[model samples]
Target: MLIGEVARHSGVSTRMLRHYDALGLVRPTGRTAGGYREYSADDVRRIFHVESLRSLGLSLQQIGRALEDPAFTPSALVGDLIRWTEDRLAREQELLERLRAIDASAPGDWQDVLRTVELMRELDSTSAARRQQAVLARPEGESVPAELLAGAVLAESDPHVAGALRWALARSGGDGVAALAAGLRSEDAGIRRRAVLAIAEMPEAPGAVAVLGDALGDPDPTVRGHAALALGRQGVAAAVPTLVGMVVEGSHDVDAAEVLGTLSQDPERADRITTALAGELAAPTADSATRIRLIQALVELAGTSGPEILRRLAHDDDRVVALVASALLRVLEERSRTNRADEDS
Candidate 1:
């Protein structure tokens, strides 16, 4: 086949075929009397081979080496090509994500588009300060889409930036609760914790509350603790058990105790909270430290009710528990006496 015919037969263009010939990659076998280039079957086969290698992202130089060099290994070259392709794919995916975020912002003009892009870039900045500023930099009356904030808050690891993001999401009035809810169900523990924290900051919406309630049973104690604390503040009675557990485990026990005290404002809930703490104290499985923490939590419960548990614990086996309980019991007794005196006066 002649050059034109070869171009027609294979998708390779005539100019490229000639360029290949000039590089000695694929030379035609013969020429006609007019001295035009002519291709034999073998030459056409080599052209097809070069095109095939090019489709695999091989450069012309590499294709020449691959086709002519006996020592050239396909394994190493293919591995490099695979890596290059993966890098390109990763870049494309990142760009796609950025575009999606920008589109989600619903920018009204090119300037708005640029601002949203800039905001997103800063939100992902390595500096926590910059990420925080990005969130606070939103122009008045310009609403950030909740979806973007939800993703940022879930992935944020820096405490300051995460706090700013949570505040921003809360101010958004639970618009992103659905996205945050998905984070609650994420397999990543860090993500689940972030999700619950962000949700806790959100305004009380039925959807957000439901997600928070479901998180009460999360296997991660930190997640469960955060959920329990949020639910306790929302007056959800289901959080009582987890709050009591937090007190016994001494994880955020002070905050847990405070919320438990709030929950105990209800007479029925107070009895239940008191009963739960006393039960944990009596558990044979509870160690000395756990019992001590539980006793401290009891004191933070419904007013004078703690003294009864304290009096009982004062005679406990653990000397530290006995001493701490005895001291707290005395304080409660003095407060009771003072209150009675004031009432009589």
Candidate 2:
């Protein structure tokens, strides 16, 4: 029978039949040479499963993924769906309470309007249970759903949520780097900060690099700081360009310079490294503290490069500066002696 006949007999819409067919949920018992769908009794049963799930508030997309392959565990989706529905109910209840207000004509107020705005923003930002459930409703291989991600941002106010998300991106067997990166733009500063940290820790993925690279430019200093540190962790030479830009922009020159030093053995960019340290040393806003820290770090890690830094600080006019410089030089000298001794053995 054709789809219209299946719709009449099974009481499932022809559109749904087409969608289910697309999902491999129901195939015609046989297709006409012309490719029109021809359903059988088994097809009707598949449609029943799909319709039943949809009626239960499962989106068509979710129902198709579930019943298209019964192996698709509904358990995978239930917890997320419940959270989304509950959140919606809570918002509606709050709206209803406002509507019952006696003095204000029971219409929309500024608070309601603002809440709605936040609701929309949340739809764009994170991937909490509510957010992720919606993503699950999307077609397989589809790019991430923005609204679904927004709900995840709402949960970011809780530090534990942000921590979990960070850990998930870095540690979980899931796909959510993009979802968490979306949190960086959240109106909530703390959420953005935590999101950056999470993004910072994600295993090196193509999108992860780009997302964290962009985050390094976040208007928030804390976010920028986290981004700088995260990119350094990846040790990708590509991040060097973005880090350089941040320093040039004055977002955090000292940190950027330190991170540049942290870049993997980019012996080819020795000049850039030299330029960065010189830039930091010359930055008018760069304080004595930042320079001292940078020099100490360079002395500790850069081997031969440490000599110049030690030379400068050890001989500086400032007595305190010279004392710290002398200490670092002694440490480096002792290490050199140890290495020479090991060689003799």
Candidate 3:
């Protein structure tokens, strides 16, 4: 076939076929009397092969080696192509997310778009201080979309930056709750922990209570602890068990104790909280430190059984438990005496 016929038959443009010939990628086998280039059947097939490789994202140079080099194997080249394609896809995905964030901001003009873009870059900056400043630097009356803050809060690892992001998210008036809720479902425990922490600060946010209730069952103890504390402060009794567990385990036991004390303001829950602490103290697995922590927690409880439980612990077989419980019992009695005196006076 002549060049035009080859172009027509193979769907390869004449100019491209000529360029391929110039690169020695696919040369014509013969020439007519007029000296026009002519392609044999095999040459046409090579053109098709080059096109096939190009479809797989192979560069022209790579395709040349693939077609001409006898030692070239598809394994290594295909693996490299896969990696390159994946990298491109990841970049594209990041760009799409950036665009979505910008659109969600609802910029009013080019200046707004530029400002939003700059803020996003700062949020993604390697400097934690810059990231935190980005969250706090939004000018008064310029509202950032809560979704943006939610995404930042979920990914921020720096404690200060994370706190700033969470603060900004809370100011969004619960608009970020949906995004934070999605973070709760992430396979990454770190992300889930951040999500719950951010959500924990927004108790008044719509659906915040429900999301926190769900997080009570999270496998990550930190996540559960934060959720439980948040719920306990909101007067939700469901958090009593986790709060008690936190005290028993000595994980944020002091804060856990305080929240438990607050929850115990209810007469009914006071009994249950007292019993749970007593049960932990009596468990065979309870160690000296565990018993000490439980005793301290009991001191925070208002139920009548709390002192009696401590009284029994005061004479326990463990000398340290006996000493610690005896000391706490005195403090409790003293505290009671002070309250009674103040009321009487």
Candidate 4:
């Protein structure tokens, strides 16, 4: 067969076939006495195999290596190629995810895609060993373990991995969701903290919400803060009442302020939250530090409620009052320029 016949049969262009031949990636078998290149049925079969592997997204180097040994049959090479293809597909998915995450943060740019592809490759490879471990164990049970999944999730620095883990947990069944939520209930404070952070990004399950509520009373104020913050992000309105009820009832003023900061997004919820926090701020037992936090939440929550709350906080002897007041004015001023973001839409 001629090179053109082989190219036509294999779906490769003649130019590409010649280029492949030049690269030693794939080559024709022999030449005619008159210097015409010739190929056989076997050559066509090899070209087809090379084309198939290239279509599978393998590098030319990989295709060449796979075709080197006489003992390596097409079926065997394809089996190996299948595994590579799966990993390649996974990397593509991760790239899409990272691009989504970046686009969420800012506008799309060519640089973002380039950075995302790099990050995606890193994430896909990082979790491979842990996924292999999970498959190897099988656990005498159904789906994979959460610890292995957690390892897979934490292996990547990108926020999209967190989102993917959360979605994966939700899809696996209620049990995976339950185990992930249960992580927030871990006795070790550090574990609880990390779990709260991870699960916060996870889908908000009722089980997870319940665990977060329990964690709100964690001995470490940081844990309580994380729990409240997670609940805010998860935003089950049912959790809103619990977060608010804890504010007037406890001394985790910083944590309470954070909850109020988030809940302030809802007018009805903000009124209830600030009303309770106001009482805490006014009481004789409240410290100057706690008062600072309470005032900050009031400032953050002050939509139409701004001047009234600002007047009260302006009286505080603490110098931070001035800084907080300045921040408020700055936010309003910056809005004049950056707030025009809607215009670009």
Candidate 5:
């Protein structure tokens, strides 16, 4: 087989085969009668071997050493190839994501595309302050795409930067709700927590309420707590149980109680809220602290049954619970009298 025949049969270009010969990677075994490079069967097999190794990302020099050096081991070189391939793949994936985000922004021109790319770079900066400024410094009329903001919001670990990102997302009028909603289903609890926090601030965002409602069942208590508090403020009665549990468990109990108090303004919800608090106080597991917190929450309720519940607790065996209940009972009574007088007037 002459060089031309080898190039045709083995698919290696003649120029490349000559280069391979010069490099001593695949020398032909003999010369043809016409003085063209002659490749025997072994040379053709060697050419195939060289092509196969090249497919695995081997450098020409490395392939030369691999074929020529008896002591050259493949394990370390193969491992290196794997790492290089992984790094390339990761870079490609990041570029793909960046392009997708930019496309999602729906830029009007190349300038808009450049600006969006710049903002994305800033959002990915090592300095949290720079990331925050990137979000805060966005021009008033220039809209940063909600998809970009949502992606930043989910990945940001800095509390301050995260807050700015959420604000920008909210300003996008909930366009990012679907993206943030995707974060809610993340297997990473931290991501779910961040998603709920961002969604919590966008109460008026389309689908924000429904996303928060779904987050109420999140496995993370922190996630559930944030969702419940946000929902409670929106007058969703489903948050009542979680709010009451917050008061009992002492997790954001003050905010939970305040939201519970606001939710209690609905007369029907007021009954349920009062009943739930009373139930917690009456439970066998109710300790002094839990009972006191429950009692404090009870005072925030706006129903006739509040004072009655407090009165029942005032005679309880726990002195602290009894004292706190007794004091709040007078306050409730005073509030009741004031209401009655104002109504009469």
Candidate 6:
């Protein structure tokens, strides 16, 4: 076949076929009457083979080695090509994600586009400080999309940066909650913990309470604890059970106690809180430490009703518990007297 015919047959341009010949990748075998290059069947086959290898992302030099060097092993070159392709693919995928985030932000001009791009870069920066600045550096009237903020919060390890991201998400109008909710269901325990922490910071978010309510049953203690504390502060009575358990286990018991006390302002919830604490204290298998922690929480929930529980604990078998409870009882008595005096005045 002539070069033009070959180009027509193989879908390769004649110019490229000549280039292939110059590179010794595929040389025509004979000359036609016009002294033009004419390809034999084997030459056309080689041209097709070179095109096939090129399709696999082989460079011309590598293709030459693949076609001509009998001693050359393709395994190493193929592995290299695979790695190169994977790297290119990763870059493309990352770019696609950045574009998606920017598009989601609905940038109105080149400045907005640049701002979104810079923010995305900074959010992924190695320096935690840069990531934090990216979150806080929002231009007036412009904001980072919540999905990006949510993604950053879930992956952020630095406490300060994570806090800033959470703040940003909270103010982003709750669009990120859906994304953060997905993180709540992540199999990675760390991601799940971060998700709950971020969501807990956005109590005003739409459906934030419901998302947190689901996290109350998270297998991870940290997740459940944070969810319980946030929900308790939000006045969700469902958190009362976990808040009471936190007191027994000594995990954030102080915060849990304070939240429980706030929840107890309602007469019904107050009874439930008091009853739950007393029941845990009376468990036959309750260890001394657990009982002691529970006692401290009860003092935080101090009222006319809990003095009886404190009085009983004051004389208990555990000397430490007795001493702590007796001290708390005295403190509770002092506060009660002061309140009565004020009411009389």
lDDT of each: 0.88, 0.62, 0.92, 0.61, 0.90, 0.89
Ranking by lDDT: 3, 5, 6, 1, 2, 4
The digit string of per-residue lDDT tens for model 3 on 1-345 reads 999999999899999999999999999999999999989999999999999999999988999999888999999889998999999999998788788878888888999889878988899899998999897888887878788889899899999999999988888653788889999999999999999999999998989999999999999999999999999999999999999999888899999999999999999999999889888998999899999998999898876889998888889999999999999999999999999999999
- lDDT per residue (tens digit) for residues 124-229 in model 2: 4565554333333434443322322322543456555444434333533344566576677678877777667765666475487788878767788777767776
- Number of the top TM-score candidate: 5
lDDT of 6 at 169: 86
Model 4 Cα displacement at 114 (Å)? 35
Give per-residue CA lDDT, model 1, range 1-345, as digits (tens): 789999999988999988988989999999999999999999989988988998999999999898888998899989999999999999998788678777877788999888877788898888988899999877777877777899899989998899999888888643788888989888999999999998887638658778888998899999999999999999999999999999888999999999998998898999999999989989999998998888888877775577877987889878999999999888778888998999999
| Per-residue alpha-carbon lDDT of candidate 6 for residues 158-272, written as tens digits (9 for 90 to 100) | 9999999998888887488888999999999999999999888888788889999999999998999999999999999999999998888889998999999899888888889
Indicate the worst ten consecutive residues by lDDT in candidate 4: 132-141
lDDT of 2 at 61: 71
Which sequence of candidate numbers ranks them by TM-score, best first? 5, 3, 1, 6, 2, 4
- TM-score-better candidate, 3 vs 5: 5
Estimate the lDDT of model 1: 0.88
lDDT of 4 at 327: 65
Model 1 clash tally, residue pairs: 0
Which has the better TM-score: candidate 1, or candidate 5?
5
Q: Lowest summed-lDDT stretch of 10 residues in model 6?
A: 296-305
Q: Is candidate 3 or candidate 4 better by lDDT?
A: 3
Clashes of each: 0, 10, 0, 0, 0, 0
lDDT of 4 by residue, 1-345 (tens): 888777677778899888888988767789988877798777778888888878876778878877896665667667877898799889998656465544533425676555434443444666655434433433343443343455345443445555555445444443344544555556766656556666665535556677777777677666666677677766545455545545544555556556566777877877776676677667897766566565666655635564466565655666686467556645654664586776776
Pairs with steric clashes in candidate 5: none
Off by over 4 Å in 4: 1-174, 181-185, 237-262, 285-289, 317-323, 326-345
